[model samples]
Target: MSADSTRGAPCANCGDYAPFNVGRAGPRSGKMLCDDCADDSVAYIVDCLDCEWSYTCEEPRYNWYHAKIRVQQEGNTHETEQRVFENESHETVWRNE
Candidate 1:
């Protein structure tokens, strides 16, 4: 049998190959997105009500994956934003506000 016949098909977003299964659903059900893409579909953000200290976290669609956070800081009216990727431990470090 061909690769597709045995492993279903490649993902539509990132072209990651996925195997067919009876319990698959959501993106996998339609062969649209891979596990990585599914986990990165939605993003969530939380901000401090007092300061410009805000951070965003991308919600995992299926599995726990590395997600980056965009941290924003306002210093003396000079706004600065930094993009920080999560480490192996899924931790993010920021400067004191």
Candidate 2:
């Protein structure tokens, strides 16, 4: 597909302009997801293995938009960090420093 063809138009997944659905979280990241992709994608929650750092938001199928979440470490300290959910599995956590 031409770069300009998809400029600010249509769903990023299917290239169709009509019948678009907005993904509130995950890979879609609030972008326009076609009805097909929306149907195929699943919702997930992210949690930390070390402490009570669980992500409790309904994002799209495989994307995240956590740019300013307060994460409490094992020591009970708060820190602002950015995180992203990788796919529906939601097993990945990235810290933006």
Candidate 3:
């Protein structure tokens, strides 16, 4: 089958197929994933290089205040760093330096 034939094919992660499902590419593996699988994957991560503060999320949006609150709740007073990654290639899309 040609590449075009696989446009609405079953999701590589869930093996579910639907004509209206416009699957998303897996962030880590590049496999075609259904909406649910894609939304459940870890697409972004926040880490503090100086401390043990870390947070992860699958959504494209990240809450900086929430991350800070988490660090504070953990008694981590170190300066927190924010990092954003793309869902397609897992590349560093943004970083607070």
TM-score (all chains, Cα) for each model: 0.29, 0.28, 0.29
Runs of candidate 1 with Cα error greater than 4 angstroms are 1-5, 22-31, 43-97
Candidate 3 has its poorest 10 consecutive residues by lDDT at 86-95
Give the clashing residue pairs of candidate 2, or none. 25-59, 25-60, 26-60, 26-63, 27-62, 27-63
lDDT by residue (1-97, candidate 2, tens digit) is 5344333346566766634223321234556656555554333444554445554344333343432232223112212232333222212343432
Clashing pairs in 3: none
Clashes of each: 1, 6, 0
Cα RMSDs, all models:
11.6, 11.5, 12.4
lDDT of each: 0.42, 0.40, 0.41
Candidate 3 wrongly placed segments (more than 4 Å): 1-7, 20-30, 38-50, 60-97
> Cα deviation of 37 in candidate 2 (Å)?
1.6
Whole-model lDDT for model 2 versus the true structure? 0.40
